[model samples]
Target: MRVHHLAALVLACCTPAAWALESFVVKDIRVEGIQRTEAGTVFSYLPVKVGDTLDDETAAAAIKALYATGFFKDVRLEADNGVLLVVVEERPAIAQITIVGAKEFEKDKLKEGLKQAGLAESRIFDRSLLEKAEQELKQQYLSRGKYGVKITTTTTPLDRNRVGINFNVDEGRTAKIRRINIVGNENFKEKELLDVMVLRTPGLLTWFTKEDQYSKQKLAADLESLRSFYLNRGYLEFNIESTQVSITADMQDIYITINIVEGNQYTVSDIKLAGDLLLPEEELRKLVKLAPGDVFAREKLTESVKLITDRLGDDGYAFANVNASPHLDPEKREVAFTFFIDPGRRVYVRRINITGNARTRDEVIRREMRQFEGGWYSTSKINQSKLRIDRLNYFTAVNVETPAVPDATDQIDVHVEVKEKATGAVMFGAGYSNMEGLILSGSVAQDNIFGTGKFVNLMVNTGRVNKTYSLSYTDPYFTSDGITGGFDIYKRVLNTSALSSVSTFNTDTTGGGVRLGIPLNENDSIMAGLGLENTKLDLGPNSPQRNIDFVNEFGRSTINIPATLSWRRDGRDSAIWTTSGTTQRVFLEAGLPGGDLTYYKVDYQLKWYFPLTSLFTLMLNGELGYGDGYNGKSLPFFKNFFAGGNTSVRGYNISSLGPRDANNRTLGGNKRVVGSIEILFPMPGMKNDRSVRLSAFLDGGTVFGPGGTRPELEGFRYSTGIAVTWISPMGPLKVSVAQPINNNPGDNLQRFQFQFGQQF
Candidate 1:
């Protein structure tokens, strides 16, 4: 087609402009070349219209404006005999926009967020959109405290007349809190003030939790907390004057300085109450645990306020606010305190709302919530529910919010959001101890079983001298009253050749039991259970003749009904990384009269975890077991206690530390006590995931009979060893090489003993 003909044809199809008539002045002006655009949109751009003169400059300006809309590519103005024409070529509509180099964010989310800045996928490409995207990217980084980030945008025109956009971002080094300096502090030292602040030095753990990274938002919060700290303590005029943050010359470190003006410290001069109370004023005053002539303490005052409000709440005043205001006397540096209370209308919780639980069932959260619909609002119960959810270990984060419903003045709805985490795990572990060589154990378990707060576990133990199989289930909350229940089934075979035995015997055991757990209090519980067992004995070739006579006198193939009562108290900081606490368990088991075994066993175990510092932890474990038989007999030798091995004192052979015979084989005893001390610290140059650890341990113990006629004190043995543990993908693998520190006569000192998947 000819160029002019094609142009004329395009003009004919689009809006037609007014033609110049001979001797006719242009009375009106309009735009032609308008496609996919409203005629009014074109008219709105024209500087001249009806009854106004139409010149070439005016026509050009109108055409330019129309093209600037990013809707056109060609613009021209034609004037014939003072009649002007505005002609333009419309741009093609964007068919698609493809984005690349978006790894930090999802493509769809970035696309949607870009649309808010006039960069929709189907819209025509423009340089302005790229500029806007760069700004948005920088803003996103700034929100996350990444001030050193760099963002670049590249635009490419595609074959289909569409544009491809790429946003290349360089998230530079994180700005960490290098130093926090507090100035103008008289009462407290710099170290003390720094301890009060949450921002801390970047230590070995900084990379894991990222808490040492500096953020203006967090610093602002810390400053506010500091202000409250002084103000609550009767420093009413205390104020933070300025906070300055400066970056180092290398832009790698950040230094923060906070300047504060601490006002006069005051003592309590008088106390008064200004509130309507259902009880006498004296009673209300007593609830506030503050008195005249006492030094000003913000924490105590805050607690006192809460106490008054809680007291009112218990009397059906659910919406009560208590504020303690201190009036300072600057001359005497004394303050007079007044308690102000406001009791709003009593209201009940109409309903509780739950949200953000994308996968978990609603009942899972609801079951843990102590608050109920139609019940009086209890802040304590709500807080307790939050704690319970946190303890579930099924969620990384849980939050509960109460937003008042619109048009419902006295009613509020609660919203709970939970982010789920992986709680089910399968672990296969093996370890070598001086006691049990090449021990293998594993567990396949679910912590949150069937979306309920319960546990189910299956375990297996395969060791040189011990083999065990067990299945267990526990319901943490068997009833609404916080009681728990558990059941276990196990079968084990144990060999005692390494043990210092009074007799040469091995035992094969199969048992199953059920337990009922009752909660005596929040931190204390009691458990009682009955187990049925069948025990078989195999006398070794070198069995003591007298011991064999005692066993034959006692009989084999015994049926035992062992019932035990146990108590445990745990106060460790972390179960795996404890710095300080004690765990003690005591139990007593007595076989029933109907069973073939007629004996009573008492056992006690005590464990202490002491955290010396951020890098060191010490653990001590001790155990004592004593058993006696009644009715003219003794406890079976197969069921006796033995010590020494990886779990026991490390340097000696398995069960080799106790009393031994001339042949170096273990002779079972009626009483035993074992004690071990282990020092655990981070493996040098390793992370805190505790994937690997190095430890040194000392173990000492002995086994003796009721008459104490077996081994002499000079023959008592002990062992010491170094251990290495790896928390690998399969499970925990441990290897220890121990040597006997003290050896008895005929004792075979184990030069090296190793194990995997065990802890001692």
Candidate 2:
């Protein structure tokens, strides 16, 4: 019975083996269910070869590897006649990609930027990367004021395992500041305080600087500046209560409200002093510039304390401490100030340390410093040195500090840091004006020559009837004591017009001069020069017989000596946009014994700028000129003054503002006076940076008799015009179209002039 049972078990096992043999071993591989994938590609993933054994284990492994390619949605593997077969269904390929709701950035630019983040067109798509890209793009727009924007993407399957994606965008309106309110001011009106803030209403130029548009960060900064302004002025109790920013119901505008508590205004009622007295009390008082009755200006008070400390240090008190305190009177709204001083120890300069001059040589900065190592310290010299460094133009900022040694309080280390900026410029320009039509001018100047503290300029002026070429060089420290010297060589040609029987004449002049400039004070200087000139005069037919006769009498070989004295005071807030200040210059030029000509010429110019608001500025300019000759000779034709054109009266032709000949041609004016007033604002759509400026200007002036007659008001031509100025990449481009307001008989109404490259 046991033998029979064993036989039954063996037969049962043998029977299962016989059944498995009925399934044939694979002889060849064939893959099915592949839409866009090749049979060979699927076969490559299989671990079994044609000659190897195939089973469910190996077939399952092959299916998993095929699916891992990320190109298949489903994979299958089977075996027939001992041959292994695999099948794959590829995932769709991206056929297109589209993005919507982007405005601050271009669609193509954003797409290109996203390619680096692993989201690109015409490839397998990943939803995870797409989501990241969408968030990034939205943040970019939000940073630029596009707060309400939406992005949507769509995908569509294409033929042959390919798909297309579309991203639809809806860019909402931009958020703009509607208003800014400042609270807590009693001494100054709200409008006055707002005027002090940099941010203001949007205007024609808001697009450029974007300053008119408000940002939360910028508003916060402006508020902080306001706080500092009041605090520095003795408003010790000034505080900002709250600030609120609200969006309008339409969601298109924003309004900002600020509340402040302005404390009492303080005034100086008494002044007292303590500590060391390096100078007499009277002398110290004179230098303080602060008085008991004056308003308690914190900035001025600090400056006074610094001045006292500096005075003590200059007198061998290197470690001097000066402190100022104000005791307020609540009833009188005034304060009594006291100054305390301490002379700790007399010190010398041990060493001078210089830093931040990466591009400039150390000697360049060292040469301008007044304080030296191993020498007695003088605060006055140190301050003067800082000013000199600033004037170099090579450094955008200069800072000087003196720190005393801990153990040796008598000694100090001087440190100066300089931030560099571009100091060389090459400019070229062309323009058309009534005075000098078809004008071409260019200049190459280096304020800091080759990293040295010097200046060089090459300039050219080419006009329809005149041309000038000049080369000049200046050494600011020619004498090592702040004396400046310059040398210039120039050539000029001028063609004059004739009226009625008076003929036309042409003059060619070449000259060279050496000038020495001496500084009289911080804001004043005196200059004198000697020049040698050679001139040639050519007369046309029908010319004045007397003038032609005079040129022939003098042989046209006139030598001229020109001497000039000038004074200027400039305290403008900014050169491009000035709000308040007065700039004045008076120049006098007289002929001396060295030259063949004898004449005196004088000119005076004054310009004042007033700020009406953050967006509006007013500029007034006035000029007066006079020239007269001695020895019965008229001033050289080249020396005569002429007015009109872009820089003068725009409604008139160039050089046509003064007087006219019988033929209606301009006869150069001899004595001239001109005055102009302009109201400047930003151009529409360009408020940022004030890159484009628009102005309404009124101009009036005239040129009078050749000798002694002064210009008369009755003869002055008056005009009003609209002027546009573009702060272009090259320079300032000015275009003005003017209409004569009070026209005489036969006077033209319209005149157009433009300057391609000019500062003002």
Candidate 3:
């Protein structure tokens, strides 16, 4: 058998002038030159049937149609004794694909890229598709500044009419930024403008920050930052004209040039509101935190507009739009801003849909939502709902979308999507302190038990001087009205060997308590609890006299029932990393009248965070406590409070502050006052890093016993220190160093202390 080229055969069969074709009736259809395709497939694609009269036009149409299927590389039609024969060469299937020398990208990722270009394993083999995939792979490497990357493809034929493709890749090194030039800036210095951008030339910290590597995305973002910097600094007409990036022959060095236009600086001459003020003009005017005669800052102008819009959003105006139009006077370098507000229709929530929570119940997420179905949409409530869900710590991410309902202008649907996280944790922690030596702990906790929003924890810990075992549980919505109920049972043993300032004795305490929290408002809450405990004291020959006297007067073993009442107000923007907020608490705990001892304790704490700048925060914390036994009895030796620890005055030893006993041992005090001021900032060379913090702090505190007068004020211990806190994957780690400012004789001091978990 002789096989002719399909293209020449088709051309000969279709041309009447060349082939001299005559109309003929086909009696049977036969397909030849097919290796893998079915004969029926060829017959089905033929436009003319077996008995239909066929002409040159019909034969050409049939041949063209068969080639259009992309299943055949060539197609030809022939006639023999009034019968038509269709010949097709099937495209070979790809048996396998292998990629070599692809170190910059994963083999699977490259395979996926090829697959997207229709050249994967078991797919039809096409030379054009392979070339396309090669070009795309090169482009991908080029985007990473790899200008010297090279890719080559090879195909090998295998048995059973299949072909294997191999891609050889050479991914060169990423080009490093050598120089960055900024032009056409007259007001701000080049260094000042470059300081605000993310992209930079090679520097000392380039290895960790990667700022020396050029990226299109990073360059774009840096350009925007440059624009914002000028716009916020009274350059109202700042513009980025062009950005050019050039690379060396070796693909090792990159140089970038950014051309910008900075117009004249302008000061605000007048500011007015031009839109319909839903609220009184006076009230809306008060929301504008900017004034005339101030520098025309686009950021401040936009912020004022947002404030007014948010104020309206709180009043059920969900679809409000505000625009600030500025009128410029190039001659006087002055500008006037007028805010135009458009309050669209007040939309009501038609439905509230919760999705993407595979493990957690719908009610668990719904309970945290402030917005409700069939209610007027409030932007504040919706945002609060999202924040509340985030604070639950049950989900890794929560997103809320308000999509307007179709054909309903005044109605919308609220969609809350949540990505659930692992709510159960097996925690193991270890730490070392100057006083505690080596401490180890382990716990099993579940924040969302069985997806019902209940919390349970079981913990056992052992340290050099302390051991504890505890079980705890909580139901945040005990009454379905945001009431919190919880209980904790624990057995703890404390050994005071390292804490030499305290008595060298051991105490065993076994206790359990039930507590309830009532929400008074969004930021205020009241908590009350009742507890019963049995405490036994063991005294050594080296015990302090205060401990021995307490044991002699009140027996070594005692049982008491204590009641506690507390009120707390929290206004922090964030619970973990608060920038601005104030938190205050007042607490009181008293022994019942029928208890083994009669005592009452009171304490007050205030914490305020003031944002000094966008990257710095000033935190102030103060605590004061007073406790005494009623009916002329002194405060229990074990019930007294002591200062000086990582959480207290950092320059002193734990429980090592206050007056000494007859044996020169620390005697715990009945009154305590402690205060600290910290200036918090992000770690150096870390951009937008929230997991770690560095702070400079000043700590002052003292403890006073009944034997001392004005000791808390006169004998104040002072310390200044630097501290660091890191939220590691395993847990949180804190370290501090301090120097005593008013060190006294016989005072126990711990200048440096640190706690390390498995994570940090």
Return the top candidate by lDDT.
Answer: 3
Ranking by lDDT: 3, 2, 1
10 residues in a row with least lDDT, candidate 1: 1-10
* Alpha-carbon lDDT of model 2: 0.70
**Which is the better candidate, 1 or 3, if ranked by TM-score?**
3
Q: Report the Cα lDDT for residue 194, model 3.
A: 89
* Predicted candidate 1 versus true structure: per-residue lDDT over 589-650, tens digit per residue: 87777778778888888999887656677889999989888765567666567776566666
Candidate 1, residue 81: Cα displacement in angstroms equals 24
Error of 3 at 49 (Å): 9.8
Error of 1 at 591 (Å): 1.1
What TM-score do all the candidates reach, one by one? 0.66, 0.66, 0.83
* Residue 613 local lDDT, model 1: 57
* Clash count for each candidate, listed in order shown: 27, 32, 0
Whole-model lDDT values for every prediction: 0.69, 0.70, 0.82
Can you give the lDDT of residue 121 in candidate 1? Answer: 63
lDDT of 3 by residue, 1-760 (tens): 2233445556666564666456788898888888877877777877889789877677778878887777788777767777677877888889999998888778899889889989888787888888899999898887766878888888999997899988888887878888899999898899998898888887787876677878889999999889889888899888889999998878899999999999888999988897778899899888886788898777888889888888887776778899888889999999988889888788889999999898889999899889999898888899888877877877656789999999989898999998776777766554345545554556678889999999998777676567888999999899999999999999988877655666678889999999999999777889999999998989878876667787898899988788999999988876656799899999999887777878999999999999997788999999999999997666777788889878899888777777666555666788999999999998866748777999999999988885432243336889998999886676557788899898876677788777754421
Which candidate number maximizes TM-score? 3
Range of the 10 consecutive residues with the lowest summed lDDT in candidate 2: 1-10
Better-scoring candidate (lDDT), 1 or 2: 2
